[model samples]
Target: MTPLLNYIVSHTKLPEVSIKNTVELLNEDCTIPFISRYRKERTGNLDEVQIGDIVKFKEQFETLEKRKAAILKALEEQDALTSELKQKIEATQDLTTLEDLYLPFKKSRKTKAETARQNGLEPLAKIIMSQNVNDVESVAYKYVKGEIKSVEDALEGARHIISEWINELTDIRNNIRQQLERFAMISTKVVKAKADDENAQKFRDYFEWEEALSRIPSHRLLAILRAESEGFIKVKIEIDDEKALTKIEDRIMRSNNDCTEQIQIAIQDAYKRLLLPSLSNEALQNAKTKADEAAISVFAKNLKQLLLGSPLGEKRVLAIDPGFRTGCKVVCLDAQGGLLYNETIYPHPPKSDTIGAMKKISSLTEAYQIEAIAIGNGTASRETEAVIRKIHFKNDIQVFVVSEAGASIYSASKIARDEFPNYDVTVRGSVSIGRRLQDPLAELVKIDAKSIGVGQYQHDVDQTKLKKELDVVVESCVNAVGVNLNTASTSLLSYVSGIGPKLAENIVAYRDENGAFTSRNEVKKVPRLGGKAFEQGAAFLRIKEAKNPLDDSAVHPESYAIVEKMAKDLGKHVTDLIGNKDQLQNIDLKKYCTETVGLPTLQDIINELEKPGLDIREQAKVFTFNQNIKTINDLREGQLLPGIVNNITNFGCFVDVGIKESGLIHVSNLSDSFVKDVNEHVSLHQQVIVKVLDVDVPRKRIQLKLHK
Candidate 1:
C-alpha cells in the first residue's frame, strides 16, 4: 500500500481496503454522502464523517507531498542537497517540522546578524561559543575589519550572529512552541480613545480580560480578537519569561564560563527581540485557527438542527409578515405551498382598523380553508397574534410563530424571483414563512445557511471552511430526510447526496419540460444524469405512486431483489410487507444477508420496511409566549416564560422569548447538574421554559436559567 493510504488508514481506523476504495471513488468525483450511503459494501459501512475525514487527509497529504517536491527542487538548484538532508525532507510528513528544518537554508533579507557574518565575525563567534577561554575580548581583536572597530564592537557583532544561530535551532523552536501551547496567557485591554464609544460597549467584558490562552473558550477568544480588529481593544499572548528563559538556556548553554555569560546575553536578546514576538504570534494564530474550527463546528451543528427542524407536512397555510405602520402582509398558500392570494391588514394601532381587519381575516380563513396560520416572528408579531386570536374562524386553525431569519434574503433572491416573478418581496417572504411550517429542510436549502442567523460569529470564522462544513450539514440533513421526487423544488433537490447544483437544475428542467416523475427510474432520463448519478441519487428520491413500492423506501434498487425475495419467503407482497411491524419483526434479517450485503445493510433495509419514507425529524408544534412580556423591560426576575433556542455557542445558548433582545442561558444554568455540552440539554429551535434570572435594560441583556 502507498504510504499516504497507510497513514490515512492508521489515522481513520478503517480497513485499508475501505480507505483505498473510498480514495479511488473520491478521485472519480463521487460525493461523500453518496459514497457513505450507496457504497456501503465497498466502504465497509463507514459513515459520512469518516469518509469526509479520509477526503480531507488525502488532500492535505497531497499538498504536503507537493511542498516537499518544491523544496527538494529548490535545494538541488542551490547545490545544498545532501543524501541525509534529502532523506530527512522526504521522511517528514508534518508541515511545521519541515519548515523548521528549512529555516537556516531559507534566503532572508539582510539583518544585523547577516551583516555581522559578512564582516568575518563568524570565527570569533565560534571561538566564544566553544567557551575554552575567558579572555574572549582579546580573541575578538583578531577579526578587526572595515565595520569592526573596538573589542566591544567585535564582541557585540559576534553576539548578534550567535543570537541568530540560537534563534534558528530546531530544538529551541520546538521546545518553545510547546511552552507557548501549554502556558501562554491571552490578555486584552481597551483602546482608551474608544473606551466610551457606543460600538465598543459590547466588548466591555473583554476590555480588561486575561485568561490562560490554552484554556480560553472559543467564543471568548473570537470575541476578543474581533474587538481588537475593530480597534476597541488590544490583545497579546505571553508566557512566564523566567520559565521560558530557563528552557532556552538549557537548550543553548552547554557550559558554565565567561563565554556562558556571553551566550546568556545572546539568549535574552534572541528571546526579547526575535523569539517571543514571533512565537507568540504563531501561537496566537494557531489558537485562533482552533477557535475558528470550534466555532464553525458549533455553527454547523446549530444550522443542522435549524435546517432539519420539525416540518409540519403539507397543509394549507395562511402566512402573515407582521408589521405596524405598513400593516401586516398576508398570503394564503395551497397545501403544496403555492401562493394563491395575498393582501394587507392593519389590525394594530397606527390605523387600528381592527374591525375591518378581523372581518377580512375571517373571510380569508373561511375562503382558503386554512388549516394553520404562520406568523412571522418579527416586528409587531405579538400584536398581530392577538388580533388573530380574536377572530372566530370557520375551522379550528392552529397558529404558529415562525422565525423570519433569512426569509427576506430568500424573498429577494434569484430563485425566489423566478418562483414568484410578479409578487413583491413581502408576498414572497410570507410564502416562505408558510412553507417553513410545511417543510423547513426543503425551503431552508434555498437560502444561504449563514444568512439563516443560527450561526455565532459565522462571518468572523474562516468563511471557506465554514461554507464547506455547512454544506456537509445541509447535504447530510437533506439525504437523511429523503426528498419527494414529484414535488421537491430545485433548491431542495440540489442537496440530495450525489445530485448537486447542476444536476438539480437539470432534473428540475426535465420535470418542468416533462411532468411529475412517475418512478425512481425516470430520474435517469434527466439531462447529464448518467448511470452513476442515478445509482447514487435514486434511493433518496421518493416517488409516492410508483409501480414498485420500494422506490419510496431507502433500500437501493440493486438490493430490491433481496427485499422482494424476503417478502416472497414470507408469502406477502412488497406493499403488504412494508409498515407491518409485526410481520417485519417476525422475519430474520440474517436470512437476507449475502456476500455483498452485511448486517448493516440488512438492518437498514428492515428499518426502511417498517417506516417507508419516514422523516427522521420531529413534528413542528405551536408555541405561545407570555402576553404580558413585550420587551426586556416587561421581564421580571423569577418569572417562568416560554422560549425557543435561537443560537448556540461553546459558552452558552441564546433563547428568544418573543422579545427584541435574546436571553443568554450560560452553560452553568443549562442543567441542574454539570453540563459538559450545552447541546446535550438544548437544541436550536427547541421549545423550552426559562426563568428570568436578571435584566439589565441599559445594556439590553437578559440572563435566563433553564427550568430543570
Candidate 2:
C-alpha cells in the first residue's frame, strides 16, 4: 500500500481487514455494487464511498510504482545509475522529484552537444569544462578544420558545444527554474477592439492588471486564462532573468578558471534557449490545475448542501411550472408520487383566462383530493398562485414554492421524456417539481447534480471529480434514508448500499414476475441475490408491512434474535412489547446493554419500535401566499412577507417571496443585530418572514429585511 493510502485508512478508522479485502476485490475487477453485495463478511459492510477510495488509492500506488521502475531502468540504460541515484529514486515520494532526478539521463531532441560529438569537438568541449584554459584562441584554432573553418567559427562552435553540455546538467537547470518560479508575476491585459467589433464589450473590463500568481483566486485566474485563450486578452509571466542567471552561474562556475567566461556564456545561452520556455509552461499549467482543484472543492460543498436539503415528506400535491405567454403547466400527483392528471392554464393575460384557469385547478384538486399545491418558483409563478388563492375549496390546501433549478433540464432529459412520452416538456417539468416535494432524493437522481445549480463554480471545475463526489453524496443520502423495497424505482434502488443497475433491475423483474416483497427474506429469492447480498442490503431495505416489525427499521436481521430474547425476558409477546410505550418506558434498558447493545442502540430500537416505518423527514407544513401580492410593486416597505429561504451563502440569504424572482436578504440586512455565518441563522428550505426594504424594477432586484 502507498503511504498516503495507508494514512487515509488509519485516520478514517476503517478496519484494516476490510480495506485489504476491498482492495483485493477491486484488484480482481469486482464492481463496487458487486463487491458490496456479495462480499459483506469480507468487507465488514464498508459502503461504496470507502471502497471507491481504496480503489483510487490502490491505482495511484500502482501507477507510482510503475513510474519508479521505469525511471530506474532508464537511468541504468544511460550508465548513470549510481548507488546514490538509485536510492534517491527509491526514496522519492513525489512524481516531480523522481522526474527531476531522471531528467538528465532521459533521451532528448538532437542538440549541439550530440552534433559536436559527431563532428569530433567533444574532447575540446570537455577540456574547456575542466576550466584550465591554456590559450583560449590557440586551443580553438587547433579544431579549425573540416566543419570548423574560421578561428571565430571554431570558437563559436566550441562555445555551442559547451553550452549544450551546461544545459544537460540537470542541477544547473533546476536552480534556475526555482529562482524564476519564485520571483515571477503573471500579467494579463486586454485591449479594446474597434467600436463595431462584435465581441469588444465582453472583454472591455479586463483591459489591464498584474497579480501575484499565488494570491490570485482560482475563479479569476481561470477567467483571465480563458479570456486570453479566446483572443480577447494577452497574458504573460514576467521573470527577473538577471537574478535567475546569477543563481545558475554561481552553481556552474564554482571555481574561477580560464574557461569561467566561456562557461558563463554557455549557461546564459542554455537558460534562454532550452530552460525558460519549458519551465514557464510547466509552472503555469500547475497553477491552472491547482485553481481547478480549488474550484471543484467549492462546487462539491455547495452541491452537498442542496442535495441534503430537507424534504417536505410524501403528500398529495398540485405542481405548477409557470410561464408567461405559454401559460402555466399544472400536474396532480398522489401521496405516493404517482401522477394522476395534468393540464395547462393561462392566469396572466395576452392569453390570460383567470376564470378558466381557476376552474381547471379546482376541478383537479376536487377530483384528486389534493392536500397541497407545490408551485415551481420560475416565470409567472406568482401570477399562477394568485389565481389558485382566489378559488375557495372545502379542504384547507397549503401552497409551497418549490425550487425548479434543474426541473427544465430534467424535463428535457431522456429519462423524463421516456417516463412521460405523451406529456409536453412543461407538463413533465411540473410533474418533476411536484415529485421533488414528495421525495427530493428519488426525483433528483434523474438529473445531473451539477446542472442543479446549488453549487459554486460548478461549470468551471473538474467534471470527472465533481461527478464522483456528487455520486457519493447521492449514495450517502439514499442509504441514510433507507429505500422502500416494494415501491422504490430502479434509479432509487440503484443507490442502495449493495444494489447496482443490474441487481436493481433483477429486483424489479422478480417483483413484476411475482408480487411485492412481504418480508426481508424475500429479497434472496431475486436472481443472483445470494446470502451475502441479503446480509449487506436487507438492513437498509425497509418493508412497510412485513410480518416482523423489525424489518421496517434499520436494525439488521442478525440482531433480531437478541431483540426477541429481550422481549421474551420482559414477559410480553415481541409485537406487543415493541410498540407498547408504557412497557418500554418501565423496562430497565440497562438489562439489554451489552457490548453490542449499548445505550445508543437500545434507545434507537425503542424509538424504531414505537414508530415502525418511521421516515426521518419532517411532517409537511401547509403554507399559502396572500393573493393581494403578485410582484415587487405590490410589496410595500415594512410589510411582513412570508418567504422560503431558497439559498444561503456567506454573503447573504435569498428568499422566494411567492414571485417569479427571489429577493436577497444581504448579510448586513439579515437581522437587527450582527450576524456572522448565514447558515447558522438560516438553512436551505427554511421558511422565514421578511419585510421589503428596497426594490429595483428595471434590474429586477429586491432587497429584504429579516428583522421584522
Candidate 3:
C-alpha cells in the first residue's frame, strides 16, 4: 500500500488491513452502506460514517497523486526537471505546497517579466540582485533595446523581472497565505438604493456586519454571500494592508541600498498586482468551502433525523388536505396505505356544509374502519379538526395534525402520478399525509430531500455537495432499517444498499410477475441481478413468509449454515431457537469463530434472532395543542403550551405551537446550563412544553422558553 493510504488509516484510527480491504472493495464498485453491512468481516465492523471517511480520504490521496504526476510531466517537457527539484516535489504532501514549488517554472502568458526578458534586460535584473549601494542606474544604461529606450526604462524592466521573482518565491507565498488565513475579516454593507425595498428586508441584519472570517458562523456566511449575490450588498474580505505588506517585505528585502529602493518598488507592485488578489481569492474560496461543508453536515444530520422520525405503523387512516374556499379534500387509506376512497368536504368558510361534510366523514370512517384521522396543518385545519373531534363514530379515532410542508410537491411528482393515475393532486396529497403517519422513512424518500424543509440555508449551499451528503444520509437510514421485500414500493426500495432506481423497478416487477420473494436467494433470480448485488442487498431485504426463518431476519445467506449448525447442536428447529432467549443463552459464540466470522457478526446475528426485524424508531404518539390559543394574537406572555419541534438549525429550533407562526426556541433558552447543540435538547417531531417568553402579533414572531 502507498504511504497516503497508511496515513489515512492511521488518522482515521481504522485498522490498516480493514482500510486496505475497504479501499479494494470501493475500487471494485462496492457502496459504503453495502460494505458496512454485508462486508463487516472485511471492514472490521466499521460503521457507515467510518467507511465514508475512508472513501473521502482515499479520493483525496488519489487526487494528490494525480496532481503530482501531472506536475512532473509538465516539468519534464519544459526541460526544467532536476534531481533536486524532483526530490522536493516528491517529498511534498499538500497540493498547496506542491503548486507553490511549481509556480516559478510554470508556463504562462507574456507578462511584464516575459516582455523584459525578450528585450535582453535579464542581465540587468541579475546585476540589480547583487544589492550594490552605488551605480545601480549606471548599470541600467548598459541594457538598451527595443522598448528599453532610457535608463529609467531599463530599471523599470529590471524591477518587473524582480517583481515576478518575488511573486513566485514559495516562502513568501506560503507566509502571506498564513497571514491572510489568520487575520483576514469579512465586511458587508447594504446598498442604500435598495434598503427600502420589501424584498431586501430579509438581509437588513447583515448590513454593516463585520466579523473574522475564521469565526463567522456558517449560516451567517451563506446569508452574507446570498445578499451580495442579489446586488443588495457589497462584501469585502481583507486584512490590514500595511501589516501584511511589512510581513512580505521582511521576507524579500535582505539589505538596504539603491537596489533596496528598486526591490521595495517590486515588493509594492507584487503585493498589489499579484499577492493580494490571488491570496484574497484563495482565502475567500477556502472559507466558502468550509462554510459549505458545515452547512451540508447540518443539513444531512437534520434530514436523517427527519427521515427516521416516529411512525404510526400499519393502520387504516383518513387523511384530509384542509382548505378554506377550495374545500377540504379527504382520502381513505387501507392498512397497507392503498387509497380506498376520496371526496371533498366543505366544512369551513364560504360553503360551511357542516352537516353534509360530517355525514360523509362518519360514513367513510365506518365503511373503511378508519383507526386515525390525519389533518393537514394548513388553512382551516383547526376548524376541520374541531368538526372531526365532535363527530360520533362507532370506533374511536385518533386525530393528527401532520405537517404539510412538502405534500403539494409530492402530489405533483411523477411517482404520485404513476401510483394514482386516475386521481387528482388533492387526493394524492391526502394519501401522502396518511402514508407519512404510517411510515415516515418509506414515504419521505419518494420526494427530494431538499424539499422536505428540514434544513437551514439548504438552497444557498453548494447543490452538488448537499445532494451527495443527503443521499448518503438517506442510504444509511434506509439500510439501517431493513426493507420489507414483499411490500416495499419502488421508491422506498430504491434506497436499499445495492438497489438503484432500475434495480428497484426490477424488484417490484419481479414480485408482480413471480409472486412474493420466497427466499433471500430469490433476489439473484431477478433479471440483471448478479452475485455482488445480491450479496450487498440480501441482508437488508426481509421476506417474512420465507420457508427458512433466517430469511426473514437480517442474517446473510452466507451465514445461514452457521445458524443452522447452532440450531442442530441445540437439538431444536431454527425457528424454535430464533426468539428463545433461554436457548440462545445456551449456545457458545466461540464455537462460531471462524476465520471470517468473529464476535461482531455473531453478536449481530444473535441480536437479530432475538428480535427479528426490530425497529429502532419509536411509535408515534398523539399530541395536543392549547385549546384557548389558535393564533398568535391569543398567545399571552408566561402562558405555558405544548409544541412540536418542526425544524432544527445552527441557531436554534422552530417549534410548531398549533398556529400560523412557528416559535423560535433559541439555544440559550434550552437549558439552565449551556446547550451546545439544539438537537441535543430536542429532535425533529419531538414533543415539548414551552413558556411564552414574547409574542409579536403584527410581525408574527414568537419567542419561547423550554418548560419541560
lDDT scores in order = 0.89, 0.75, 0.87
Provide the RMSD of all predictions against the true structure, rounded to 1 decimal.
2.4, 5.1, 2.2
Global Cα lDDT for candidate 3: 0.87
Best by lDDT: 1
Residue-level lDDT of model 2, residues 495-519, one tens digit each, is 7876777898899889988998999
What TM-score would each prediction reach against the true structure? Answer: 0.94, 0.81, 0.95
Worst window of 10 by summed lDDT in candidate 1:
100-109
What ranges in model 2 sit over 4 Å off?
A: 1-62, 70-83, 108-128, 134-184, 194-205, 238-240, 256-258, 269-281, 577-614, 619-682, 686-708
Q: Write model 3 residue lDDT over 1-708, tens digit each, in one string.
A: 578677687669888888998988998888887788767888888888999999888877788889999999999999999999999988887888998889898746578888898899888888787786577988888787678899999999888988888889888888878888898899999899988888788889987899999889888899899999898999988888888779878876778777888888888898888888888888988888988998888788788988888889899999999998999999999998999999899988799999989999999999999999999998888888888888998887889989888889999999999999999999999999999999989998889999999888889888988998898999899988888899899988888878889999999999999999888888998888888788778888998768988887888888899999999998878999878887787779999998888888888888889988888899888998887778898999999999999988888889999988999998888889888777788888889999999998876889999897
- Please identify which of the two predictions, 2 or 3, would achieve the higher lDDT against the true structure: 3
Ranking by lDDT: 1, 3, 2
Query: lDDT score of model 1?
Result: 0.89
